[model samples]
Target: MKKTALLATAAALILSSMPLSASAAETAAYKLSIDNRTISFPDAQPYKLGSDVMLPLRQTAQALGLKVEYLPASKEAALYGPAGTAIVKSGSNQARLADGSPIEFGADAAVKSNRMFVPLSFFERALGLRTAVQEDTATAAIFTPEQTEAVVRAIVERLVAGEYQQLSDLYFDDTMKQSVPVEALKAGWEQTTATSGELTGTQVNQATSETPDQQQFVVQLSFAKAKAILSLNLNADNQVSGLWLKPIAEQAETPASLIEEEVIVGEGTKYPLPGTLTLPKGASGPLPAVVLVHGSGPNDRDETVGLAKPFRDLAWGLAEQGIAVLRYDKRTYVHGQSLTPDMLASFTVKDETIDDAVAAAKLLKADSRIDASKVYVVGHSLGGMLAPRIDADGGDFAGLAILAGSPRTLWEIIADQNAALIAAMDDGDPAKAANEALVAAEFEKALALAGLTDEEAKAQTVFGIPAYYFKEMDSRGADQIAAKLTKPVLVLQGEADVQVYADKDYVQWQEALKNNDKASFKLYPGLNHFFAKSADGKVEAQVVQDIADWINRP
Candidate 1:
């Protein structure tokens, strides 16, 4: 039982998988020694080790002479030539050919020079050919004529017999890639063995996306037994370029605590913008309540992704903690195409956020169980950023719990921040590849036009959008709204958050609230911007993901 097994000839039937170490067929591990000295900085990890073939896919595919056509209409690719054809769906395994039968193989397919290339071995197997893998060359030569015929014959025989729903030897191919070492996956496999079925399942769903050169399939398969989502990237060459297996249990829906009543915000002509209302169990009488505002984007109340729901967690967590929560879907989710960040400036303070929240607040205030004067605003992220404007008009809210709110005008803060990101570089110095002088010139030109009147601003470009409304944003600060405020303002910051650091917004609040000592500030030590704690809990980590359940709002 060696890791590499000889293909069954048209004469016999056998399926054998041996360990990589014991397999005589194993080639010395390939290391992408593209020194990348200038590109790979000293502090940078040399390379993402393992089977991430960073090499150009087009070069390899052309060497093999495969006809690669990335079909966008079906979101699957058709690859054929000297080797048999394979149909690759975005995010799924590479399809194989066994006469009328098909054998599937897993390897990543990516594009290069406007052409598709696949992982060497995967390309071979999908075409029913025998493969010779060479680590030093990071190449797998094909022996198609004899082996493919035999493979097709053997595969057909196996399908007829139904020996197994799928072939196994999954680890051997991975061992060669060296990206995610086999050890971690083995550990995960063993630890979740008992609970695998509940966590993972496989689906035949196919999705596709256009990369630089060719279109690719984004396939989503569930390893139900493992409770994981396995995403495969199949390029036009029918080779897999990316394979991601993420845990599924972490995505299960938490049963929401039953309370009383949920609300429906406007159903945009496009999608449902339903909202939820949570009340504490029992008791009675008017309770002090707060309206929950979402951050930027067309996020659902829960901000759904595959398995995590941060907003839902927040709403439910707070509701169970005694505070009533009212939150709704963002316009983006409701009216997908009608609204976008590009037109955000066109949306006045009221049409976008304020009016809906105020309407909800007013509605809540009318509710016999909610105290009108005691109503507060709990705004997260962009919600926190926009809170001052809403509070400026709401008049009735007693205070605001601003979470990760940015005090600086968004345009300036965002520009300075992007400048830093675009400036800093490490790998091949991930630094900005764009011409800085050009960008600076554009910036200066844009800002000069920023001084224009509203009508004039509409005529000039600022940050890819019109500059008219944006100039006003530069002069407007959160402190201005706070200056008019006469209530308790609790500024909440996650110490590890970089997006809206405690130093930036908190200090701004402290200085702005000097005359209004009623403004209180607290930092969540371990939390990121999302109030979630993690060493990696910075800008990217804080994105809200709502996945499943009877619970979250997304």
Candidate 2:
């Protein structure tokens, strides 16, 4: 199959992708924080230079309570903290500590946009502060002498002791008090303990922050029946801002009747993907098979979201019914970190999902034990949206099953989702109007996608994603593609799903395929996006049975 320049630009809108440029100053890829509080850079944000975080000298030094002097003629900066005075030269990895001892940075300090940028390690090594960086989230945090792990430990102790009133009075800010009152906190704890059994113990897992003003501590709580996570949020002033307790669900055991074999999709190709092929044990004849494709983001073969492993459940459940199932890790999941900016610049849905899915389908057809004529493709979310295209792009499946997918363009659905969120917000909220205007602006950009040249699309970012990605998929609406297909299609939706609405998205699929007598649609009550009962990992057995019954029907 010939690959296109189009990539999963919609997925990039929600999932983390490599920045379009390698120049950290241009991309501002790293989020800087101090003492669990996010640090905002009004002019130049912190960026990653190799493994090191580069921060503007003056701003970072001020944030760290240090005095800084810059010598522009020689391009060097001297930082004065209580520990000592350190001198750093721009475009050099070598620096002198407060004690005049020579020190080296992981990467060279540089000047960008008239600002001298120094490695984050300078504060740690010269000023005697502690620092850590999370590469996955692109976050860098610095801890001062005033900030200690003991602070979060004390907060956890107060929570475990059930001193809601004291916690509220001493720790919670006015906003937090209104949002999570003492009574509310007590009731929440009671409800949690009642459902999850008494909290035997608690462990502070990690401390992090999303924004500049708020810090968060994730605490793991052990219960008699299950485990739960408590997210404790604090403001820069050390006041409690938010609190949430969610119980973790245990995963269902895989049945013994199923046999899983390790397989490779797109073998000997540029991007070979590892996959799992699940089949029923002791089956007598060639088995009907289906390939399971993922939605947005870098999903594992199991499509594990929180506790619900929907793809794994489907693969096991279907195998038990005498069908073989193929599920593979998404290409982005396997190779996203390794992809260069050039590779992602022209990358499209074909590169992210479709090509690998087609490869998996072909793999199934080659297996002698599998009945090639009965092979099908089951796509969830983004995968579902691109199912017909996958078929047109050489999947040539016996049938296609779409779960919780939209027939509308990806950007249209995103716009609708934002509009829905704005509608649900209080009219008096100051943020509501701002969000509305932002959505409107994004919608306008999305509208302009079709007219832009390839270079323009690649250069512009719409709705936080590369415009070219959307431009590539502009010609391939799921509904338009599905309308041209002669193969049978099964469209399943969860009525309660908030991400893809039943009335808006599912109904369109029904309308588009209405003339196809072989098309089937089913809506499950009280199910969410995963066709699971409230993300607890309990996928409706009926959903699996329905797909199996539909495929096996005469």
Model 2 ranges with Cα > 4 A deviation = 1-251, 268-270, 340-345
Instruction: Count clashes in each candidate, considering only residues at least 3 apart in sequence or on different chains.
Output: 40, 6
**N/CA/C clash count, model 1:** 40
**lDDT digits (tens) for residues 1-554 of candidate 1:** 11122232222111011111111112233332211111121211211224432222323333344545555566445555532445654334455342534555544443323333344445444553334434555433444333323333332233223321121122123222222222233332333333444323234333433331122232233445434444444322223334443344343344455384767654343334578887777746776676888776556677542343556666665566556777778765565444543465554435556667766677778778877777778788777877877777663677777778877766555455445544553336221344244346546755575456666665555544446545655544577877777777777777877667677776887777677766766666777666765321222232221110111222
Candidate 2 lDDT by residue in tens digits, 412-463 = 8878766775687668866567667877988999999999999988887676
User: Whole-model Cα lDDT per candidate?
Assistant: 0.50, 0.76
By TM-score, the best candidate is: 2
